[model samples]
Structures are given as C-alpha cells and as structure tokens.
Target: MSQNQSRVTEFILVGFPGLHREYYGLVSFVLFLVYAITVIANATVFFLFVTNRSLHKPMYYIILNVSVCDFLFSTTTLPKIISRYWFQSGSISFIGCFVQMCFVHYLGSVNSFIFSLMAFDRYCAICHPLRYITVLKSSTVHILSVTAWSIAIIVPLILAIRAYPLPYCASNIINHCYYDHIGITLLACTDRTLYSFPAFTSAMIILLLPLSFIVFSYCAILIAVSKVADSKNCVKSLSTCSTQLIIISLYYVPRCFVYLTSHVGIQFSTDVRVVIIMLYSLGPPMVNPLIYCLRTKDIRECLVKQFCISTGHPKAQVSVVTN
Candidate 1:
C-alpha cells in the first residue's frame, strides 16, 4: 500500500441503522423535539447575552460562546441526518462526509476548549473575586475564545488534508459516524499512524488536557468557596459552581468515553454507537439552557415570563429556596 494508493473518490455513510429499522418514527419524533428545544434554548441564551446589559459581564459572555458552540455543534450533524433519514438516502458524498467530519469535530473541540475557558473564568470569579474584574477582562475572554476555535480549526484542517488523499477505492462505506479516525484508518491501505498520530494528539489536547484544567479549576473554586465567611455567599457560589460542574460532567463524560475508552482498532455495535453519538451530540444543547434556567435566577424568570405569555397561562410563582 503505497502512499499514493490512499487517494480515493467518494465514501459512504451508513446512517444509524438503529433508527432505520423499526424506530424510525419514534426516533424522528425524538430528534425533532430535541432539535426544536435545543435551538430555542440556545438561541435564548444568545439573545439574552446580546440584548441584556446586565448579562454583559465576562461570565455570561463566556456562557454565550458556549451556547453558540453547542448550537453549531448540534447543527453540524443532526439536521442533515434528519433530512437524510426523512428523504430515504443514507449516503453522503465524499466531500460531504469530509466537510461534516471537519465541522463536527471543529465545533465539538471548540466547545470543549470554551468550556475550559469558562472553568477558568469561574475560577477567577469565585476563587479570586477581588481580582476577577481585572483578571478576566472582556478582551482576555475574547482572545481565549478566538484562540480556542482557531486552534481547533487549524489542527483538524491539517489532519483532514493529510488523511484525505488516501485511496478508498476498495470500500466506500464510511459508516454513519463522523470524525472517526480509527474507522478511516481501518479502511485505508497505507500507514494509519501518520494521520492517527496527529489526530490522537489533537484529541488528547482538546479533550483531556482542557478537561484536566477544568477539573483543577473546579477544585480550586470549591476550596475557595468553602473558605468564604458569609454562609449565604458560600451557598450561592457553591450552588452556581455545582450546576456548572454537573453540566461539565455531563458534557465531558460521553466524550471522554468515545475518545479515551473506546478501542482504536475495534468496531462498536450499531446500537451502542448510535446511542453514544446521540447522547453527546444532544446532551449539551438540550441540557445547557436547562442548566442556565435552573441555576440562574434572572434567566429562569425571563423564561417563565416568556412561556407564560406565549401559552397565555397564569405565571406560577415558584420560590427558589437556595440552601
């Protein structure tokens, strides 16, 4: 298998077989609901961050970026998948496959990196409140966010270019998964490590390294919150941080499993792969607004008011007893 042998024409994407069989209607309904809810939820965050002056601070600024990333990440794959399923065509062209893989990974990696930035922001805000204003300036947050996406895009682009020219004339079936380094390597005739090495390293950096930083930052935040003199302040800070922690854990766990635990050469069951894919892809966008609405008082009120008005229902006042 010469290096030149890797160059190929097109690839096939076997759309999730789990939904293709008996659960098509159910799966479609679930995805549609999730997609609608995710879009509205993330868009609300974006809108609030943009329109509200009170939300102009660094923390909500970072949250806005996270929302944007979640929206893009979900849109990269889920919509097209729904369309293909409805239209009864499971195949994606070679170019379509490559672009989808690139965008999905690019956005997913950016989301992870931005979450790290959020952790850092939370750390500074909670652990060093006095210096928070100066430490996490708007420019600094912007730089970090931009840098996160820039690196995410460049690394994937290089890897895609290097790995793409390979020949796939033997088998065109790319499976339904996106950004699968192992799957691509298994189908390739030449050395897989060249592509896998950079791809693996990038994944480790994007997934593990930022994850370590987030974990460390949260530890520091928890310690700092514990030392606060005001019990009310302590409770408030802990509540916010705990919510962030839960959301972070939810977002990171499935990703860590996919990137870290899954064997490189082995193939996973269709059901397992579909379930895992659905969980991570849908989790962030769906759960994010729920997190914000649950944890933040203002956003929750706004949502409730908006919902009450939309449905013409009585605005039920629920007391938030923060312990």
Candidate 2:
C-alpha cells in the first residue's frame, strides 16, 4: 500500500446505518431533546448536591459523583451525534476522534466503578451501620472518587494509544453513532481482529470486575438484611437497594448482550445493534437521576428544599419512602 493511502487524517461517522437520509431530520430533533433533558436532569442533581449542606453525607456524595459522570457520559457522545444528524456533517479529525473515544469509554468504565463503590457504601451502611461512618469517611470518599477517575481515564488512554499508530488505509467511515474503539478499529487497514479482539477482551475484563464486586456486595447486603428481626427493617433495606440494582442492570445487561452477540453468532441488523448501543450508553444517565429522586428520601428532600428555599418559600421538610 502506498504511504499516502495508509495515512488517515479523519473519519466519517455514519450516525446509524440503514436510517439513510429520510429520517435524519426526525432523529436529530429527538436526539436534541434527549440531550437537553439528560443534561438538565443530571445537572440539577449535581447542583443540588453541591448547594445543599445537608447532602454532605457519604451516600449523597456518591450520587453526586454519579451525577457528574452521567452528565459527562452524555456530553461526550451526544453533541457529535446531534451535529452529524443535524448538519449532514459526520467528519471528525483523527485527534478529535481519539479524544472522543477515550472519554466515551473512560466515563463508561468510571460509571461502572462508581456503581460498585456505591454498592460498597450501601453494604456498609446497612450491614454494619456502626462502622459505616468510619468506612466511608470524607477522606475515604475522596480517595475512592479520585481512584475511579484515574483508573477509568488511564485504561482507555492505553487502549487509544494502542490504536494510535495503526494505519487506516482502507476507509475512514465509522458505521456507528460516535467514535468508539470498535468502530474506529474496524476502519484500520491492518488486521481488524488483531486490533479489535485484544481491546474487546480488555474492556470485558474491566466491566466484569466491577460487576462481580457489585454482585457480591449486594448478596452480602441481602444476607445482612435477612437476619434483621423486624420485617419492616428488612423490607426497607431491600427497598433502598432495589433502585441501585435496577440502575446497575440497566447499565450492564445491554452491554453484556452486545458483547456476547459478537462471539455467539447472534445476528442483529446494523440499525438494531446501534439502537442497543445507544441505550447502553445513554439510558443509565437518563434514568439514574429519576430513580434517585423518586426512590431516595433525602435527595428528594434536598431537591424540594433547595427549590423552595431558592424561590423564597419558608423552610420545609419532605420525606416519602417509595415502595
């Protein structure tokens, strides 16, 4: 192959294959609305957490971190996609694609880890209420928070670096929504499997580690809750956990399907597969804030109190345990 042919300077993301030109307008409009809602919803949670002094506890801090991750996760991929569908512009510079791919994967991995930390916090809070304060002190939260961000960013950086020197001689058209490792690696003129498989396996490992941790912690939580003599206490414990469990499943289940489909000979049309991918990446951030607000008492209290006080209403208390 000629040297010039091997040098790839940019890539074209074909937003969602099979949609063609007819539906771009509608798709763009919907994406814009979803993007707006995602930002607004998570930002409100993050802002509330920051502004409210009563929310300085460990669990709320975890939610605050998750909120920030949710905002960034959507921000990384949505704007690029919105512009692609809106303007018929899908071209992204090589460096720009690298940055996007890094953050998309980075924030994803971070969210998984963050969820695991939350599971740990819940376990301590419920199973060992006395030690909970000591286990998740402000210092510990800061360390764990920094660790999640650092590892998430570093691992994806290594993956991106691995793809850095690869030559894209064939074509630069990415067949999915945003600049993901799989889509970008597929365009490389070299052995696509050679480049793709290792990265795929690494990602699976990163995903599974947290998933395993979450499972074990939640199981332990179940055991602890079961031993409680009061049935009401047991139910309350399980109820608090149910929302986190739902959020965890939302984040990981579709991802497992997408990953397993490749190796198991499952067939999905390009559009269907892309739709699944969109849900995997976008669903958690959209649903997490709602689940927390609707399920958790303290955060709703924080939200209501913050809104009311900010609007000049008298101080008030709010508490409703959702069943």
TM-score each candidate.
0.86, 0.94
> lDDT of each structure?
0.75, 0.86
Q: Cα lDDT of model 2 overall?
A: 0.86
Q: Whose lDDT is greatest here?
A: 2
RMSD (Å) per prediction: 3.7, 2.4
Cα deviation at 16, candidate 2, in Å, is 1.1
Per-residue lDDT of model 2, residues 1-323, tens digit only: 55855567888989888887888999999988888888999988888887877788888888888889999988889988999999988899989999999998899889989999989989898988999888899789889999998888877998899987787787888888888888888777778777677887889888999999999999999899878999998998998888888888998898888888878999899889999999878878888899988888878777777776777666343322222
Q: What lDDT is reached at residue 234 by model 1? A: 92
lDDT of 1 by residue, 12-45 (tens): 5556755555666676667778888899989988
lDDT of 2 at 130: 98
Question: On a 0 to 1 TM-score scale, where does candidate 1 land against the true structure?
Answer: 0.86
lDDT of 1: 0.75
